[model samples]
Target: MNFDKRAQLIRKYDVPGPRYTSYPTVPYWKNEPLSNEEWLQSIHRNQKHFSSDDVSLYVHLPYCESLCTFCGCHKRITKNHSVEQPYIDAVIKEWQLYKSAGLEKSRIKELHFGGGTPTFFQADELVRLVHSLLENQQVDPSEVEMGFEAHPNNTSKEHLEKLHTLGFRRLSLGVQDYNPRVQKAINRIQPFSQVKKVHELARGIGYNSISHDLVFGLPKQSLKDMLFTVEKTLELRPDRISLYSYAHVPWVKRTGQRGFDENDLPTGEVKRELYEQAKLRLLDVGYLEIGMDHFALKEDSLAQAFLSKNLHRNFMGYTTQNTPMLIGLGMSAISDSWFGFAQNKKSVEAYIDGINKDQLPVFRGHLLTKEDLVIRQHILDLMCHFETELGVHDSFDFNLNVLLRLKGMVEDRLIEIDGNTLRITEEGIPFVRNVCMIFDQSLQSSASREGVFSRTI
Candidate 1:
């Protein structure tokens, strides 16, 4: 690797960019309010298209015992456990709404429980929630992929065992950093001991895919600290590791990120080096890089998917499941029908109120235009497979200005354009987001100020 050349590229391209989890990212989602009837119509259309095949479900459990100051997810922090049952009831009610409204397909190909903290609820409550969602549905245990985000400090052995017994083969534990200073700065002081116990317990209960979530560019983090954290993490030998860049979105997540000093966070070349060094170490240790910020062993499904070119990206990051209809239930959860995107209300009160009134709870959404749909595919191709093909007589025409915008990146050797195809060079993998930005007409056409997204480094 050419260190000098890499450093120069990083300096030049390291700027605020969307992670490309979605083509028209949340901010650029047209700000269009979607009615319950429209949301159901989209679902009905998807049901017809999908036939009896299953869709994906993402259930957001927003309760957290405490705040992880560096977390950027939507969460409600409180010591009260009373909020659990009511929230679960509302979520189940919301799912029922979809079922009763002509969503004929109930078989779930994939189901994921995301934070604030999924294990914040008691094990029994979780069991009831899952059962409610799958009640009378055609869920084949062997065909389903189930997983959840777990906080090591709070996830009891029962939490692991119950979920495992219920067919959850994947588990992701948040281990941002083992360094005490870094943890303190982020207000997430979990020791390695706690992580080990949970990891071992999950493995003993037969969880096949265990993922550890780590972060770089956190407050007070350094190259040395990152190396040490990677070393400790490798000791665990998780099936997958997500080494994410700390997104300092204080304006959007004021209370969650304000505990740390901005100066303490690594920036620019320093932050880039942290990720590069860690990536090198992980690769050297038999972990294959899967898309951006994710590494997995050869046997992991994510790696297999990447190799087979069946990998997919969504609001839940990378996944082997590529269902056309992804139904998200709970406050602030976002659902995606191939043609549209909708988000439930962020406030728990409003979400439950709408559910109680037999409403869909979707407050906002975007119906993708023909142009938006075409650009979305190209961006997804770049993000998941690092290449995209455009045919001469393709039905969807890409913006000519987008191709013009790629001139500099192509000249810099970040990408290669051959005929109607574009491929990201090996040197351009780290700058994939920059490559995708060339096609982001929404961002290019925007008049917004800075700080809409984290730096691409």
Candidate 2:
């Protein structure tokens, strides 16, 4: 698609919407006192029907030394290193809680460390954490995948080497942008040299799937800025690239997005162009676009997953693995049992308190209904593959009004509808979120849209 055509589509389709990381997204979750005991039961119940008891694991280390004003993740900004051991211990205890609940024998096929800065903990501390989780467990390196998010500024050579030794091969760096003006605007001031050095160190340690994260539509971002950032990124030749739209949702409390003047940020077609032009450069360099906002080399597992139509997504975003159950062990971490969703307490202190009391730290959860499960499948199909086929026997009777709503999109060439099958056009990839929102019964039925989600461009 040309820049002009994409720009025109942006005007027609850019609107605030959920990214659909989960269907019946968080806001629609029936958090009206989820049963802690019932949640555990759901895990056992789901395991019975699921093909494998092996699960994916996500550990959220929510401590950061400084604030990145553009970040919206749940985190606490403090430079104190003393807080590390206690947090690590608490997470280990949480893992034990699940093991005691009868998951002691399940193999962890995937493990990911995500956070304010995963490298904030000492290398030895992280080693101890991984060791404890994998103790008495034998995992084949090829079958088990491990990854972590790293802040290039603070990630050390030891951090790279130690994690590689622990079976983690994927290293994702948050290189939001290399432009000084944009960096200053977002309050993340790592230099290009810093990122390059970290990249080289991780590469030297034999980390195979290195990914660089880039964001468009920042306060001072421009088409030139994006091109330059992509050019600098190409010098490193990362295996995967994530070009995310900088979601401007200052209404979200404590996100620190308010640090920048909203007026200075790009909007509408301008922001869309930043992605379109940068995408062209990546395509020219032989990178294949993954599900959304991500690209990978043809050889990377992620690209292969997309090509093979086996890609999966969860709270941690896209993944090469589609484990039936995801066990999250950390403060504010979320767990998916394929039948229910449970979240640990958001506060570090409270989470540790719950674990100390020999209790699950979950403060909120949602048990999916049969209809929700069917809707979830359709949404997943669209998000991962851009199309879905519905039959009359499908459990959830999709609303007639919902299908009628797609008339506009079909007329715009953003979608093609024939009977019960829906497919987004090649030109409509950027509007996937917008297209998904139409199928969102909660968002469509609700009376309000304010303060819920960011623009979908």
Candidate 3:
């Protein structure tokens, strides 16, 4: 398709939509009928299906030295190092509370550090935090897949070496755009040289996988600018790449994205062309699309997971491992127990106060209904495999009304429906969020959709 036509299509379909990171999608989560006791029971019940070696842990480090204009993630902006110790101590206390809830310590199989910039903490502090968790748990480091996000400008040799010693094999660095103007607009001033140095340092420390995050459709971004970023990214030769569309939702992110004007950003057509251009360039350089917005080399774990049909998606995006129980620590983190989802308090002081009072620090959550579970499974399949088998419905009480709603999408050539299976066609990749929307009963019934989601395109 030509850029004009593609842009028109995006304009037509780029309505408000959820990212499908979670089935209930946070906004639709039922805040009532949930308590910390119910949350713990859900985890305990789900843990019975797998041994301790199958659990995954997600730790949220919410501090960042500065704000990035296009970011919508939960974060605390401050350059002071004084906040690190108290936050780390609170995280340890939170983990101890989980341990006290009867969760077995030996069951951890994965540990991922997500952040406002996990590297915002000093290297030794990070080591101390990880060691504290290990000290209280009976975890086997050999079986654990440990990783963290690193800011290329601040990630040092000591950081890499110390994290490597702690068994972190993977690292993801944010390189939103190599263009200096775009970097300046986002308030993240990182040079290509700094990124290269971090990449080389990570490799020198024997890190197995390195991923770079790039963005398209940012304010003041052009085709030439995107190509420049892609060319520079190719030079780094990272194992994985996440090419994300810059979601301009100033209503929610408020101060973060307010730096740039809407007129300065590309329109739908230009944005689509930018994505298509980057996609072609990446494929030419041997990166396979693992799922929406993510690409990996053929030999990388992500690609291997895709080939094996073992790919999974969670709040952390895509992963190779599927764990029914995930414990999210720190402020504003959400933990998914398959049966239910729980989110912690968003304020650091509130989190600390709750933990000090010996509480779970969870402020809200939802328990999945029977329909929710079925829809969630299908969404997971579509997101991971680009197709899903509806045959699994024979054992569940799913309403066929949802399938009837997808007929229009099938006619639009966005998807193919065949003998109880629905597959997203190549033309439908960009509209994956729309296809998932067909099954979102809550969203369909809601009166206010505009305030709840960002654009799907």
lDDT of 2 by residue, 327-426 (tens): 9989889999988898888888998999999898998888888877877888888888888876543643465666778888888898898778888898
> How many clashing residue pairs, candidate 1?
0
- The lDDT, on a scale of 0 to 1, for candidate 3 is 0.86
- Candidate 3, residues 157-185: lDDT per residue as tens digits? 99999999988999999999988898888
Which lDDT value does model 1 have at 143? 85
Q: Locate the minimum summed-lDDT window of 10 residues in model 1.
A: 391-400
Q: Compute each candidate's TM-score over C-alphas.
A: 0.97, 0.97, 0.95
Model 2 Cα RMSD, 1 decimal: 1.5
Candidate 1 structure quality by residue, lDDT tens digits, 81-198:
9999999999999888888887645678899999899999999999999998877765566689899999999999999989988889999999999999999988888999999999
Q: If ranked by lDDT, best first, what sequence of candidates would result?
A: 1, 2, 3
Clashes of each: 0, 0, 2
Candidate 2 off by > 4 Å: 1-5, 392-399, 418-420
Best by lDDT: 1
Residue 92 in candidate 2 has what lDDT?
90
Cα RMSDs, all models: 1.5, 1.5, 1.9
Collision count of model 3: 2
**Which residue pairs come into collision in candidate 2?**
none
